[model samples]
Target: MAQTSSHVDSEDTVEYWLFPNISEDGDQLQELEAFRTRCFTFIQDQSQNYIWHEDSINLKVVTKRTAGDNPPHLYGKTRYGCNVEDEWFIVHLFRSFSVTENDVVIRIVDSDGDFLLVEAADILPRWANPESCINRVFIHVGQVHMISIADRPSSITPLPSGQPSLMDAVHIVRSMPHLTIAPSPIQEPIRQRIEKCVSQIDSSLHRCNVFVPASVAALLQSYPTLVAPAVHAFCQRDASQLQVIRAMRFFPPETRVWTSVTFTKCLYAMLVHRNYQPDHRTGWTLPPNGDPKRTGSELGMKLAVGFELLANEESLHQQGGDYSLEMDSRWNRFLNTLKEKGFFQDFLESSQPYNELLEKAREFYMNSVGVEGPAKKPVILRLMQSVFADIEKFKKEEAHLPADDDDSWLSVDPATLDQILGDKFGLLGVDDDEAKAEILPKLETFLHRKSDYEGLTPSSGRKKSRKLSHLAPPSASRKTSTLSNTSDVSQLSNHIGFDPDSFASAMQGILDFALPEDNWDLESNSSCLSSYSEEEEGGELVDKEMNNYMQTMDQELLSTDVLRTSVDNPTRKESVMSEGCESFSDVENFQPVKIDSAALESLLASYTMQRGGPGPASILLNQLNLPRSQISASKKQTD
Candidate 1:
């Protein structure tokens, strides 16, 4: 059974039928569910069919984790069934799933009813029409064809409403002969030539960042035979071979002009810059290695593919739809820039390299634009300088305008801002004497102390009036609870009665008892120690202090919940079934509580001061999945 549908707007109305080859056990359906979530975000399902409705399109997809039971739908019997809208999206699916025509029948329809039938209108059977083409056109092995109606399967059940359904189209299309129709005679030789020519590219010269132009993609989709010859010419980097456009007899007459113009501009760009540097971004490579210095198209089919690569980069910057005019503008701008760079002067046309390019351009004009053709032959040299006059003139016209205002707080000292904030917070309720008395002085002192201890003052903003060698007098610096280093050292020395000769002798005697004079590398006449008691006493004192510090740290760690809470509850939830899903549940399930970096830093600094170093802080950061190395790097950047 078949039904005909009239043409709608192809741009707004397009459909795709995906039939995946699943194993007998249907384990692949689970994988398809994952593919659906990762790629087609519109299809959200959990062991069920997902029907997506939109203004311009509709999708009925099966996104199940298992093939438990088949639903009573037109496509229920198949292992997997889904509809795709985007062309590249389908291609990605085919490649990722390793889909072949034999495994599953894939069909596409646009406003024209059948996309492939419209494309292959020149070669379809006479009996084929809108009615007959319905459910007949299918894509197999990367090629499009219309299957015979006689191949329809008998198992297709008719709908109760007496309307046609695509239930058996998959079986019929997949059952058809793999190579039902051979390549057209006209396309055969061109295909072989392209394969031979492109194969000559150096194996080491890897091509990347390649994007097919829309004009080229249309030909690939419909009239693929014509594409190879064009590609062959492009790889050769020769414009004279543009006579290949005449061979595209099956394509409409206007299509030849489109192909020729695209080929001409791209080929000419390459000829203009014969010694152009290789650009990895543009996938630019020199012509096939070991060719002649002044090589021209021997078979007259050479066209450069470089512009196709280069032009897409610009199209990507803008909305990537219909970039033919954009490519032309970019070509003109490229020539203009080269002219301003002094690549072509008055005598350049007479030079050997430019003259060769001019000759090729003339051939391109002759072949693409015949004597009776509507286009007039443009002078190649005249086109080169279509925009730029000279470097100085160009620079003057394109000079950047200065900004109107300076809205910079970059020059404001952070310390000054901190002080101002403290004063503002203190004066928040100054009208109430009780509140002012209670908050004002305490708030100011607390803020000042916090800022000072955290080293929030920028080194650049700090006054550098004092010399590094000159220590500040006691009154000049802020007082602390502990005695100054100078005072501590002076008092300790005075209390111990530190006589230089006696102190040195005692240290030498202790060292001799522990380390021995014979083991020393020095040649001085140092005697052995009287005893090892002095060295043993010092070692015992250090051990005793270390044990006390360890006991204090153990008591604190046991009392605090920092490490215990982290070990008990993790931020990111882990589960056996968890994957990289961006579903609502996955997104809402976990959200990190934001902590102020400054506060965290201040707290960590206090912990380090109490514990004697950054050892505990590093361990804490590790538990939080924030490595000390990363934190240190961030801290350095902030500083």
Candidate 2:
């Protein structure tokens, strides 16, 4: 078995496998050779002779869980790992990265233990999540495979010896990738510990014989990790570190146990939010904590883990599987209470607008009176924003990336890859690839296209991808010349030919002569060029001529290329308008009337009144009990 897949710690990283096919690269092959050191050359088992040749290293693995059994296909032997053998290649450690049911996380720790994270893609080769645990694999004589060395008698714990370098082992295992399945079946003691926590909340969550809101039901399917991190270690709960994405709990954050009152409130919220079918009846038992008016990722915080397990052995009873999470009497009795309120797929995304909220609320108000369960697929709110917020809050971010979406089973481990892929009744979200596949049958119909609104945004529409894309990386330094000094100000001097007093007097005289004292006598420099006479034709003719000339100049300014460009630029247009009076510039500065208020109200009232069924006007009249307002204090004073 390989040692832990190493990650740089400043920023914690998840475990994942990289490069499934290792034969093509010569460098990769050489790197693989660097880690191999022959330990056992040959060994013999009952059926056949087992050979561990000089070049090939014996791969080792430990069972993910002692009780959980792997499917026959992934096992290295029929009963090879039932007993321990001296020749071991992989060793299982206490702490290894855990994988979702997919047996894969997109991240991979190569055989070298060099953490390799890849750009996520919708590709043929499926990506696994960051792995924390290396699974037990099948081993045989003269084999190039690995086997599980778990489920050995409790009395034996091997005195592990003669190990390769930890990193070297890691490189070898990852390079030749071992069979990684989920841990062995839940052992008896741990199963007992987990089953003890079962309550109405957990039972309802497990979808045993009771019903829950889509919100609560969805939580049940995913709460096991946080709820029961350890079935056997309740006394040492504080010692174990549990991190779940957006782990919510029952309201009043302090309430760990689920009560009937809490349950009612959760249902009320679904009703208010309109997460029910069109014909269901919403009961009147709404808890203040589950108010529908509330919105955001923190909508239901109390429903998180630290709760009980709702493990129904029936879901775990696979035909060829020997798995069961044992439950006690108290747990079974607690589940009976949930029979009345069935699960419904009425949860709407928090991002929806006011109108959608009203619509959903209308649908959810119906009671579950005769319904079995939610007829439609579960509605999962995409609360990625909330999930990432908590991740950043805890501070493991080396870069900005969304954490993996967790849809693992809440109680019965997770469904196999095939079961998960073929699922049609799951919730909708980034993690619900199977559900998304079912929903999005018209693939090309949803291909993203540029919104017309963006083009009409009246802002610069430069392609941001040009800057962000790797194809046209920005240059370190642009080639351009810098400005040099045109002249030296230190070398320049001022000269005056006359005394200060004389020069001042001369300048005053010049101003007096240059500026006319009379009101309309050659008012502008244009008067000198036009030679307009104020004495003839009442001076109105001169004013008209001046106005006409100014109008023509204004038109010329508007026609200029510079002014046209300024008009095209919103910033330039605003700046020019703010400076002073501009021709038609005030239009841009015009403030719109808040609404077409009076006229709009009148039209709506009239239309509603005419259409019947308490028209918009009648509704207003009904609110006030008067057709119109009368200004009078006489009645008020009498009262």
Per residue, candidate 1 scores C-alpha lDDT tens digits across 528-621 of 1212223688765655555455445545654764434332324322321132122123433433322333444454454334332346554443
Give the runs in model 1 whose Cα sits over 4 Å from its true position.
Answer: 1-11, 23-31, 34-60, 63-102, 150-165, 179-639
Alpha-carbon shift of residue 141 in model 1 (angstroms): 2.1
Give the Cα error of residue 360 in candidate 2, in Å: 39
lDDT of 1: 0.33
For each of the candidates, the C-alpha root-mean-square deviation to the true structure, in angstroms, is 32.2, 30.1
Per-model lDDT: 0.33, 0.24
Model 1: lDDT of residue 572? 24
User: What does candidate 2's lDDT look like per residue over 169-215, in tens digits?
Assistant: 32333443323211112122222322332222222221111122233
Deviation in Å, model 1, residue 385 alpha carbon: 44
